[model samples]
Target: MDRLTPLSKPDPVVTLDEVKANLRITHSEEDVLLARLIASATASLDGRDGALGRALMPQRWRLERDQFCYGIEMPLPPLLSVQAVRYLDAAGIEWDLDLTDVVIVGTDPAVLRARTIWPTVLAEPGAVAIEFTAGYLQVPEPIRTAIIRSVGSLYVNREAAAGAAALDFSGLDPYRQWAFG
Candidate 1:
């Protein structure tokens, strides 16, 4: 996991040419949601503490659905479980690409030097393509081939969801549910 001057999100504005928009996520609202929920979540767990928080949430942002690019910072664990991915995916409004979009930004020099941290452990996204500032990276072929030989990546929500506590994921069916059909 690359590190930088610790900072909270609201990362500086990146021109459209700077982003790759891997999943065709064209709405600024989507970007905002991703930044806070996904990126912020990942960053929270990533190494570097206090400082990295500030930079990651820079207090502001600018978006352009008319543009897209890749490369960014995020925190991801190695022994990443399939269920974790599934839960995260389920949380998403809709996963456009076969992969998940991870945002990485930190304020630790050591992290940047390691470079191979989160991105290095990047797991296969099936057909999904993870995109960011560094570049829109597809789950390296080797990983996909390997995971294919593994068990499965499916999510199930047995309990009923309540108000406020309820998620607006009514549009998407469970990956397993659709598969069984």
Candidate 2:
């Protein structure tokens, strides 16, 4: 799975104003630096877990498979909706699968289950495409806090220090997806 739409604005996990407040800055001198740090921190946290937390903003993701498996697990969490599912037939004709044939289950890395059976696809890489949107309309409190702290930490420590204390990410660890089996 790959994110087709890289983080563009309309919504950011943490805004510039929010970051500035976290850093306790009242001036705009380092606005550019703060913005970059916020983006970097958000990207770092977003990719930390395989499938945990919401996107915090609407974004597109594409899941590709070599064939129509019995069950396909989505790669992102808190899925808001499944946009489309397109497949390449044996004859090399691309077709969109009917919504009735697919069922979405669970919010964390939403699972896509085939109703009866999965259709055949052209035997090749990425023969099936699943496009979906995952995220929250507003960033959750814990996630928002994590982003704020991370930006502050990154700003304070521009470079790694050999003996410096590690940035506490324990607050964010609970939000990660852990495998039990």
Candidate 3:
């Protein structure tokens, strides 16, 4: 693994209005603070468990690999599509691999398999670049509820006692990604 860069991020799963309503905030006094918290919480959740909630919104990511292999597993889950696969040769020239040569194998942490030819890459870091899209168009109810609960908890418990847990994410366990070795 070299670099996993986000080309585009999905629209926020929870809107400002929805969060405000959940917080029962009628005024705009804390709108900025709430908005910041919402973004922070969403990002935290998005990256949690290897981007479990990424399916709630379609996002594009660029994955850079140090070398080319027969199969490559993307870092994120719920892969929507592979945009392109390009590699840098030993001569420092870049070439695009045929899209038809690549196949998506699994859903959770989608795996890409090379069909006929696997290109040789430079013997350096970031020698291969794969751009792909993942995530969902609509947010799930459970995930939305979890976000709301987390935002509300953070808002209410901005100043929690030492050693106290601020938010309860137990409800999100069902939707969370569990890794198996």
Best candidate (score: lDDT): 3
Better of 2 and 3 by TM-score: 3
Estimate, for each residue in 25-133, the C-alpha lDDT of model 3 and write its tens digit: 9999999988887776676668423335444578888888899887787665678888899999989899998899898898776778888768777898899999988
**Weakest ten-residue segment in model 2 by summed lDDT:** 1-10
Better of 1 and 3 by lDDT: 3
| lDDT score for candidate 2 against the true structure | 0.70
- TM-score for each predicted model, relative to the true structure: 0.19, 0.83, 0.85
Q: Write the per-residue lDDT of candidate 2 for residues 21-136, one digit (tens) a residue.
A: 87889999999998987776676556323234335566766667777766676654667788889999999999999988899988776788989888888988788888777776
| Global local distance difference test of model 1 | 0.24
| Stretches of candidate 3 exceeding 4 Å from the true structure | 48-56, 161-164, 178-181
Question: Candidate 1 vs candidate 2: which has greater TM-score?
Answer: 2
In order of listing, the candidates' clash counts read: 49, 1, 1
| Full candidate order by lDDT, most accurate first | 3, 2, 1
